[model samples]
Each structure stands twice: as C-alpha cells, then as structure tokens.
Target: MKMMKNFRNEDGFSLIELLFSITVLSVGLLGIASTIPFGYKAIEQSAKRSTAASLLNEGLEKLKGYQYINLIESNFPDEVYGDIPDFPDFARTYEIRMASDVYSSPIPELKMVTITVFWRVSATNEQRIFAVTYIGQRR
Candidate 1:
C-alpha cells in the first residue's frame, strides 16, 4: 500500500531531469550541424576531381586519333592555358614530345603525349590531373 502511494505521487519528470535532457539534445544537434559544411566540402572536391579526370581522358583520346607520323611536337605543341569547351572554371593543356627524351631505351617511332587538366577549387586552392601515353607506329 505504501509503495503504491509513492508511485502515484511521482506522476512526471522533475525540473532538473527535463533540463538535463534538453541540454544533451542541444549538444547532439550542434555536433551534427558542425559537420555539415565539411561534408559539403568533401563532396565538392570529389566532383571536381571527377571532372578533371574526364577532361584528361578526353584530351588523351583526341591525341590517339592522330597518325603516328603526325604525333610530332609541331602538330600538338605545349599549350600555355586553354579553357574547356563548356566548363568555365576548368582548363586543359597538352605536350607532345619525343619518347627518346623521356625513356632511356625508346623506339624511333614512339612519341610521348601528356594531357593535363586544372582548376581552382578556391581562391587559395588549385587542383590538377594529368594522363600520359606513348604512341607508336600502327604497323
């Protein structure tokens, strides 16, 4: 009978308990809110990297379409800075050099082609990606 009377009198949580719960919840929400910006930054960086890689691959593919004899530095000289067709923030450049210059044992018909893609992620941050391939006579 005595235990039942005590249980009936304690109908709801005390003021201190309610305050503690509110404080814990607020801290947890603040922690989650603090991480959102970092998550957005990471996703943005990944997207930029993907775009740079695609640009590098596109440049390399175009070079591969040229004839082996035509793969000379005269045809595709090193570019200083060139903008992407539709991507305003990104730029691309390429260099075509003799394989002999880069490799110790190089074939006479081999030419080294390098494609580079670059972009600025922020005022102080820059990102770049590149691809290299050796082209030789088709025969």
Candidate 2:
C-alpha cells in the first residue's frame, strides 16, 4: 500500500487579495488627505479669533488707565486710543468701534463703555465682531 503525503500550500497573498488590500488602503489614505485643507482652515480661524480677543483686551486695558472722570463723562472715542497704540499688523484689516454712554444702572454715576472689534474673514464678505465692556467710576 502506497500512502500520499498531504502538503500545505504556503505561498504569498494571491493577486486578487493583494490588489483588494491595496485598493482599500489607498481609499483610506485619500479620504484622510481630503480633510487636510479643512483642518488647516480651522486652525487658522482659531488663531485669528485668539488674536482678535487679545486686541480687544488690550483696548479695554487702555480704557482702564484713563482718568476715571474722563471715562465716566466722556463719550466713547471716535478712534482707537491706547498706549500700545495701533493694532498688530495681522489685525490692521479689522474695523473697530468704541461706544460709551451713561445709562440708568444701579451705578448711575459710572459710565458704561463697549468696545467692538470687527474684521472680515478671508474670502468671506461677512464681518466678524468681538466686543468687551467696562464700567468706569466718575473721578
């Protein structure tokens, strides 16, 4: 009696299997690549927002240092005023509005001041605005 030996076939992946795996991996990589631009845009927007907020804070601090009497009695200045002076180069394109008023509040003697900073996002006609408020006591 002759016995036949059973040998297991151990070859590399078949053509079909290899092609399918490459196709799937390529698709996944392409999908991830498509999102890169969007991620970059989000990061840019966040940076712009942070810079705008800082500028707004700087404007507020300038108001704080002014004579309390000037703050309470004077209307919001038509222009941006501060020791730091001008906006950083990045923010030069932004439009800023400053408003001051004496309103009927618990503190009638104090003035209510609002500072708003506005800018146009790149490629967008819409305006973005950031604002800060402070109350100043009559000197």
Candidate 3:
C-alpha cells in the first residue's frame, strides 16, 4: 500500500532521466549541423563544373562555324579568357593543331581542336577541364 502511494505520486520523469534525454537530443542536433558545410561544398563544386562544361561547348561551336577552306587555311589563335561578370573565377583557353593520318593516306587533312578551362578550387589547388575534337575537310 505504501509503494502504491509512492508510484502514484511519481507521475513524471526523474531529474536524471530528463537530463539524459536533453543530452541525447543535443548530440543528435550537433551531428546534423556538422554535415551542412560538406553539403554546401559539394553544391559549389558542381556549379563550377557545370559552368566549365558550358564554356567548353561554346568555344567548340564558334570554331565549328568556319568553312572548310577558311578553317583549313587559318590557325587557331590562343585565347586568354578573363573578367566575365558571370564567371569571375574562371580562366579559359583554346588551341588548334594539325592532326596526322586521319584518312587512310597521310594527306594531313585533319585538324585537332582542344579547349581548356581552369579555375582555382582553393587557395593552393587548381582544377581544369579540357575538351578535344577532330575537324576534317567539310564535305
């Protein structure tokens, strides 16, 4: 009968149980908070890669617009891309060189075009993306 009376009186959690629950909740919240920085970094890197790919495609399209005679006779100039309002951190360049043995015979009628995009991923590390394509005399 005395034990029943004590049990009835203790309808809520003890102080130790309440403190333990609070500590557990705090640790779980902290663990979730720790991942936010890594998620943000991943998102940033993805955006940079997307921008680099777009630049590469644009450079190739401009080169492809030239006619076969003009494209064959001319040399691709080295370009230093800088100071775009949209992509402030990026640097881009491109080059064209004669390719060998594209046909069965050694006429040297083919050309290899390469586009390179670079950026600083961090204070000391650099990141780059390159695209290469072959251009033959237009039919």
* Number of the predicted model whose TM-score against the real structure is largest: 1
Cand. 2 Cα-lDDT: 0.57
Ranking by lDDT: 1, 3, 2
- Which prediction has more favorable lDDT, 1 or 2? 1
lDDT against the true structure, each candidate: 0.80, 0.57, 0.77
**Top candidate, metric lDDT:** 1
Give a tens-digit lDDT track for model 2, residues 1-139: 1233322355578889999999999999999999999999899878767776787777677776777566642444444323235543233122222232333456545444555655447545434445546554545
Off by over 4 Å in 1: 1-8, 77-82
Residue 108 lDDT in candidate 1:
82
- Candidate 3's residue-wise lDDT over 1-139, tens digit each? 9999999898799889999999999999999999999999999999999998887787788876787566643455544435544777777776666777333536467777678988779988879899988778856
Residue-level lDDT tens digits of model 1 in 17-116: 9999999999999999999999999999999899888877888888867887777667764443344567777877778877887776448867778888
Which of 1 and 3 is ahead in lDDT? 1
Model 1's alpha-carbon lDDT is 0.80
Worst 10 residues of 3 by lDDT: 72-81
Clashing pairs in 2: none
